[model samples]
Target: MEGERAGMKIGINTWAWVAPLTDEELARLAPRIKAWGFDAVELPIQAPGDWDPTVAAELLAGLDLAPAVCAGLLPEHDLLADDEQVVRLTEDFVRHCLRAASQVGADVVAGPLYAPAGRTWLLDADARRATTARLVDRLRPLAAEAAERGVTIALEPLNRFETSLLNTVEQALEVVDGIDGLGLALDTFHLNIEERDLPAAIRTAGDRLAHVQVCGNDRGVPGGDHLDWRAMLAALADIDYAGQLSIESFTAPALAVPMSVWRPLATGPDALAVEGLAFLRGLSAVPSAKNSRS
Candidate 1:
């Protein structure tokens, strides 16, 4: 039953259906997600106006569902930038996001919180290390603040094209090492693109992993396409990553965020969440059944 609880824990990222969700819609959606057998839901904190975390907490708690928060800071919100005001504003946002996560009962807050997504520039080796050092210094205070609220801040690495700073687990680990309350966040979509060996990368992340986000290679439903889900889950198990494996894919036919992730996946928004939960459940059962028979 211990393993059952760990393996059965699956979450859905709400941004895939953000277009169709208002505050009232989210209130309705929480119960529906619980009905679909999800253990939790992930809400993105882009700005103060993105969503109401207090209301979301009531809804999720009512349904006995867990919540996780993802940061959505922009380039102007850069913590490593030369501008002091930018760093201050970015820290404020991080603090707000952390408070929101606490209110929503989130155990972890994950995203590219070190710097802004889609903001990239070429950096020499020395400059990269310096930038990472700055990121650590800026994030340390915020990480401590989050720790007080019992929330782990997971730092994510985007693809090389998206950001030149941290493109792999090794880079993220180096950037986050010795940070008291920080951990790594892995996204399968980014993993499929950047990792030379996906399972090996997961193993590398190991105990440092604070959160996991799953989607197909094309950023769709987990099992609707050709991803090695078994291998990935096995690696997660090997690492003892006792965190929410949330499904995170964006909606298509309309570009919302400026990240340029416009790929059209085969599954619709609602179907993606429903099917992905089923797929994770199947994956979780296989090892437990084997262990039982053995």
Candidate 2:
């Protein structure tokens, strides 16, 4: 609510430029993002040594830009793991991520925090319910910690093949219901892959949605392909979900992540951020002009 713009606020995910970016590089890039009319920047706290949040905070403040923190959970970060040590380490890492997010002045710390990305397996009904229960138990404390830091923990749902746990907004809500300091972070990429109807699914998330990530079906610059972005934005408006619609995509040849996620997203990542900003702004402007006329 604090940083709402006329249209949906557009932002960029640093993962697009992660391989080539250092702390100083992001400092330089933050202002460029702000100048391009982006409302905020989503920084990935992929691992412990990826980037320094102190410097990131200073850079964002200097540019008068807002921040959103994305936590990257690896295979070892399993809340449902039988090993107590594994669960302890994962919870500790999540706490650190929340601290880093607060330090950077991010509104919310969003990611697939329920389990490690790409760590998937088959689950029976009882086992799946147990996993959901474990996730709730694991996240409740983290959610409290986030609230203490004045931030929210946004639980992102991945595709079916990626995780055995919650993979849709409806399922995410069911798991997070009555849990303090937890909300849904919807990604259009996942929605496009899994949802029966994109806009209808978005409306279902409704008031419980905390954050949004947008990209083309092929993970390219939005609007260059065939996504009904206008309808998407209109659905968001109908729900009064005033939050940043950050562009999240990965670049290839780096392979810093797992092999499954290393595929090329677009022709190039160089101009996707700027181009996406322009596209969303254009779509948002149309509604404003029409509203003025009426």
Task: Tell me, by TM-score, which candidate is best.
Answer: 1
Best by lDDT: 1
Which run of 10 residues does model 2 get worst, by summed lDDT? 284-293
Candidate 2 lDDT, 96-188, residue by residue in tens: 888888888886888888678778888888887887887788788888888888888888998886776778888898777787678889988
**Span of 10 residues, lowest total lDDT, candidate 1:** 284-293
TM-score to true structure, per model: 0.91, 0.90
What is the C-alpha RMSD, rounded to one decimal, of candidate 1? Answer: 2.9
Taking the tens digit of each residue's C-alpha lDDT, what string does model 1 give over 247-283? 9888733444564665556457788888777777776
Clashing residue pairs in candidate 1 are none
Candidate 2 lDDT (Cα, 0 to 1): 0.78
